[model samples]
Target chain A: MKYIKVAGVVVFLLLWQLAGQINPGIYSSPTLVVTEIVRLFTEGGLLGLVFGTVATMLLGWAFAAVIGVFTGFLIGRYRLASLVLEPYLVALYSVPLIAVVPLLVIWFGIGQTFLLATIVVATGIMLVFPTAAGTRETVRVYDQVARAYCVSGRHFLFKVLLPGALPFIATGMRISVQRALMAVIVGQFLVGHPGLGTLLSDARVRLDADEVFAVALVALAVGAALTALVGWADRTLSAWRPEVTS
Target chain B: MTLAHGKTAAPTRLAALTGPGPVRDWTIRVAAFCALLLAWQLAAQNVSVAVLPTPRRVWEGMAGLLERGDLQLAWGQTAVQVAAGMLLSAVFGVVLGVLIGWFKPVDDAISPLLNAVFLMPRIALVPLIALWFGLQDTAKIALILSFSFFEIFFTVRNGVKTIENEFVEVAKAYCIPQWTVLRKVVLPAITPYVMTGLRLGLVYALVGVVLGGFFLESNGIGGLIYALGSDFRTAELIAALFTVMLVGLAVNLGLHRLENLLAPWKVTR
Candidate 1:
């Protein structure tokens, strides 16, 4: 498997280099993209852009997690409220929040505020259903135990429901992170704001495919790191399952 | 008998409309919607119309776009791209997914590369594609295909992995042909996963098409959105957004129906 992966990488790079050789201007070789990555870090505003993008994404993701989990909990707790709001929530969820970029731009202007808000709205809604469903399932599973113990409402929620639903909420948060990043980038692309998104837009306009790929490589790194972090968190949280039961 | 039945059915239909279950739910929904509209109208009165238009104004803007046929044309173009892209993704994803899922060597060879590609922000690759195909429908469609294919691939692959080996063993013991086993057992087992992929594929397909439209500056709803954004036509922009949301809802409901139709035994949530 290791050899297979290495061989796969080598073949991909060779094919790419070959393509670049055949069409020098149209495609960029791995070497060129690597150099571009170096140039970007040394000469371009790569650090600042990365910081800006990551900061916005993290902030938006944090806000989404809070709001989504809370709202989802309430919806889960109240069956009637869930039923009443199902249509609206589904409509909100179904629409790619990117589709409403124009509204964000109009309301918030083309800035970090716009990007952050867009990420929050877009990713927050995506998190809600998963969280709510997870909470509902967890609560349903524990309802009898809570009733037998005659746990107070607040105690039942905090002691029983929240911990039980944590895994589901985490799962939802994991899904939302990818989407939040997408929303942030798309907002930047649309607004022509500062970030990797703007860098991508500028590179494409210059027909500098190398730079585009270079920035994409950075994005891939960030995405992979975030996904890894989420995976680690998931494993760690699930470890708590045995502890909770005991 | 026909006339009697018609009369009874008509009254029951009317009663259903006025009944508590759907009727009360719909009433609350409409009230919520109206409350939202009222809030927006009030807020619009205080704020700059350019920034936040009144609900009435937005409705007019939508009506204008509908009358001018821009909304329909743009929506039609977007729908066509989404449909084409989704079809390609479904075909390729299912085939590749099944191949990799079934064969260990194939999976070992491909999973690493697929994982890397999947992690990359696909939207960022739009420019590279534009460099190849220009800002045309082909480029848009290709982007959508790339966006959607991996999602289906992963879902189908996982689904395949979870299929019980005993079923395949039993089929083999019964002297079932390899192809027959695949068609009868594997396909049915993975139908739910395929349906899920299809649903996610629909949303991602739209994302790809719209992102392409925004970046490539093509003639679709994204183009209309970009145009509206630039012109600062807030009302029309909101209207266009409303239309997109409606399309999203319609597609979602339609896909759910499709899922139920395809796999009647399993309930899809």
Candidate 2:
């Protein structure tokens, strides 16, 4: 299986290289992309671009995590709140929040504020459902015990509820990270912000396929690394929880 | 001693809170919606009309677009591209997913490539796609296909993997042909997943089409939105956004109903 996977990647790259050789204008091979990545890192300040994009994504995701978890707990703990809000939440989730980018650009303009706001709007609502579902499940399972022990208010919330819901919250966080990355890229791409997105768009305008592929590779690496980091944290933090397939 | 009675009391109280009461639910929903509208109206009054249009202004904007037939034309273009892209994705995704899931060699060979494509922010590919397909409906459809293909592929692949081995063995023991087994057993088992994939794919395709309009040749509702935003026509922009949201909600609800109808045994949320 491992050999097949390795062979598969090699074959794919070989085909790509062949295509690039045939049409050097449109297609970029792995080697060409790597050379371009090196040049961008050395001369183009690619690291700074990466830092800018990642910083925006993380800042927005942090805000989303705080807001979403709070709202999730509110609706999840109280049935009436859940009944009133769930329908709207579901509706919002179904619609691509990207549609609101124009409105945001109008309100915030084409800058850092616009980028951050776009990221938040795109990724925040996603966390709500998972967090709420987790909270509701925890309450369902532990409600009787907590009440019998006279556990209420902050104590019940912190000691009982938070730990129980951490796994689900972690899952939500992982998902949000992916979304936050995408949002940051799209935001930057659309507005030409100073990030990897800008790098991609700049390369495209110059018809530099190699540079575009290099920047895309960097973005892919960032996404994969963040997802892995979140997954690791989730596993470490929720080690006590029994494994249940979701 | 008291714990036993508390347990019995807890369930009833919980049920009272959580159980369905459609009348009460709808009333609260309506009330909440009205409160939201009132707040929006007040906020719009304070803000510049360029920043936030009042609800009535937005209504007028929608009416204006309708009268001019701009909304209809743009929406039709978007709908056609999305529909065409989704159809292509459904065919390719299901076929590839089934092949990858069913055969170990295919899984080992193709899964890595699929995962790489899936992980990359597909928006990053827009410029490249534009270069290849040019600024045409083809570019838009290609973008939509790229965006939506993964959801269907992954869902169907996972669904295929989860099919019980015993069912296949039983079919084999009963002397069922390979084609028959696949048709009767494999297809039915993955129906729910395909439905789920289609639902998710539709949402992503909507995003893709909008992006296509922004970057590629602007001809869809997304183009209208970009044009409105550029002109600082906040009311019409808001109206266009509302149209997108309404379309999303309607499609989602319609797919959900269809899913339930087709797969009555699976209660998907």
Candidate 3:
């Protein structure tokens, strides 16, 4: 199976290279993309652009995590609060967050401010649903346990509820990683900010297929790395989970 | 998912707060909404009216657009693209996912490619898509389709994987045909998972379609937002955004209702 997978990728790459060779103007080969990537790194400030995007993405994610987890916890704990806020929350959560980016761009003026706010709102709203649902489940499961033990509210919240919901929060965070990244990139793309998205868009304008592929490769690498990091966090955080017997 | 749960409970909560009567619940909910508007009005005072418009002004802007029929035109364009793209992906994604999962060789060949594509940020490809498709409805639909497809595909694949080997063996022992097993067992088993995927996909599709509108400079809610933003019409921008939110909430609620009707046993809180 592993060999088949490896061979499949190799065949795919070969076909792509062949297609590029046949239509060099429209398509770009792997070799050309590699050359462009190396050039971008050495001469084109690619690292800075990458870090700029990543930094903004991480910052937005941090804010989203804090706000989402806190609000979700509150909603889970106080059914009354959940009742009052649920409709608005659902409306906000369901809204195509990308649709709101222009408003942020208008409000924050097409720079890091717009980018960060867009990233935060997009990722934060996505994070809220899972975390809140997980928290609700935790509350349901642990209510009797906490009552039987006569645990204090704080104690029940921190020790029983939060821990029980950690796996769910982690899952939510993991899902949001991809979304936050996309939001930031699209935010930059729309606003013409100086990031990987800008680089990609610039290349598109110049009709530089190789340059586009180069920037995309970097994005792919970063995306894969972030996903791995989230997966690692999920595993470490969920060590107490029954599925982790190993 | 939980957001959808909140929508249904909202009416009941209002009743619970005001003692079991529809009128009382309606009054309480209206009061809460009024309080929110009042808070917004107060907050708007602190900022430039151009920066954060008062709720009243935003409502008026929405009302004006509605009266002029512009809001309907923009909303209809976006709605059509989102609905079409999501439906197409839902069908194609489930079929492809099932095919890949039901056959080991297919899975081995395709899983690696899917993983690679899935890990890559798709927003980076938007410009390329625009360049290729030229700022048209095709580009908008393509963007929505691309995002929705992978979401549904991955979820359905996982659903298929969850089917224990024993169940398949039992079916085979009872002389069940492959297609019949797939229809009776696999389809039913994956219904809930597919619905979950479809919900998430719907969200992504909406985002993609809206962004595509902004990118393509089309006559959609996103385009209206872009125009409002450029013109510094903050109130109108906010109004358009509110419209988008309403459309999203309505679609989400409708899907939730449909899911409940289709599989009553799978009703999730």
Candidate 4:
């Protein structure tokens, strides 16, 4: 299966190679893309820019995850609050994060303020759903168990609800992290002169197709890596979930 | 995802008063919304109107636009694009998803390829789409269709995949025709998944339409936002954003109800 997947990828890469040649003016060759990636890595000093962009993404996503989980857990445990907050969150989520970026820039300034807001908005929506749902799913059973032991609301919420909701939160986090990347990219495209997206926009101005593709690919790699690392952490900790408590 | 669920409830309020029973619920809910409005107005105080338009300004802007008649055309333009895109993607996504789930060969051939393409940030495809269709409504429609297709497709495939083999065996034992088996058994079985996907589709549908509309459509709220953002008209940006969220809130409610209505089997007694 791995070999087949590799073969499939190779075939896909080959198709791109052909497309590149068939229309070099519009689409550059894979070889050119590779060269551009190397140049950007070596001469362009793009790593710092990558870091600059990534830092906000990480920070913003972390902020979102923390708040989202807490709020979602709260909502799930408290149906009344959930009922109240649900309408607005859904409406907010339905609107594209891209659409919200301009608002962020206006509300928050163009630099870190805007970037963090963008990241928060991007990642924020996913957390609410999973945390809330997770709470509901396991809240009752776990509450029953806790109630038999005369557990407090805080104990029930922190210990019982949080545990059961972890898997769902983990899943939502995975999705949101990917979305955060997209959101960050879009936000940065508009506001970031120092981030990878800004680099992408710069390339667009120079009409540097290869560099544009390269910067985007690098960003994609980072995004994919972030998601994989999160998923890996989730899997590793999953077995040990029973051993840990809030 | 639970993300969709959060949209149903109202926002929070700062007021300390709490009554009992259903009255409390109603009061709290209304109070929450009012509090949000108050906070928004308060928050806008220090900021420039361009950066944060007051809630009243947005309302006035919306009302003024409505009075001017441009709002109707813009709304119609966006709605038509979304409707067209959703209708097309729904058919293709469900059919393709079903085919993949039902046939091993198709599943083997398609999933890997599609998944790979799915990873490619498709907003990048906007230029390619624009290049092909030019700066036209078709370009916008195409983008919408593309964004939504995979979402529905994956959901439907998951839906069909979840169908129990034991049920299939029962169908075979009863000598049910293939079409009837699919229509009666498989379709009903995946209704929830489809509904769930349909629910999610509302968000992405707007996304697809907005991206195209902003770039291509002459009259959408998206284009308006982009224009204001570029010109740095902060108040206008706020008003435009507020409108988008309001419209989305309404659309989501309608879709949620529709999903519940369509999935008659989701008996939540």
Winner by lDDT: 2
Q: Show the colliding residue pairs in model 2.
A: none
> Across residues A16-123, which tens digit of lDDT does each residue of candidate 1 receive?
999988876777888888999999989997889988888889998888888888888878888667866777787798876687787788789887788888888888
Q: lDDT tens digits, residues A1-246, model 3?
A: 898898888888898799889976567888888899999999999999999899999998999898888888777777656766767787787777778777787678887788878888888876676678778888788888889989867898789888888887887798789989988998888878999878877876776778767777788899999999998998888777735211
DockQ of 3: 0.63
lDDT of 2 by residue, A191-225 (tens): 88889788767866776788767877887788888
- Of candidate 4 chain B, the 10-residue stretch with the lowest lDDT total is B11-20
Cα distance off (Å), candidate 3, residue B177: 4.1
Q: What share of the true interface contacts does each candidate keep?
A: 0.65, 0.65, 0.67, 0.24
Q: Which regions of candidate 2 fall more than 4 Å away from where they truly are?
A: A243-246, B1-21, B164-166, B174-177, B267-269
Model 3 CAPRI quality:
medium
Cα TM-score of candidate 1: 0.89
Where is model 4 more than 4 Å wrong at Cα?
A1-7, A26-29, A77-80, A133-165, A203-216, A240-246, B1-19, B45-47, B127-135, B164-166, B170-192, B213-219, B266-269
- When only the first chain is scored, the TM-scores of the models are 0.91, 0.94, 0.91, 0.88
Writing each residue's lDDT as its tens digit, candidate 2 over B212-257 gives 8887888898899989998999999999999999999998899999
- Cα displacement (angstroms), candidate 2, residue A67, comes to 1.1
> What lDDT would candidate 4 get against the real structure?
0.73
1 or 4, greater by lDDT: 1
lDDT-better candidate, 2 vs 4: 2
Docking class of 1: medium
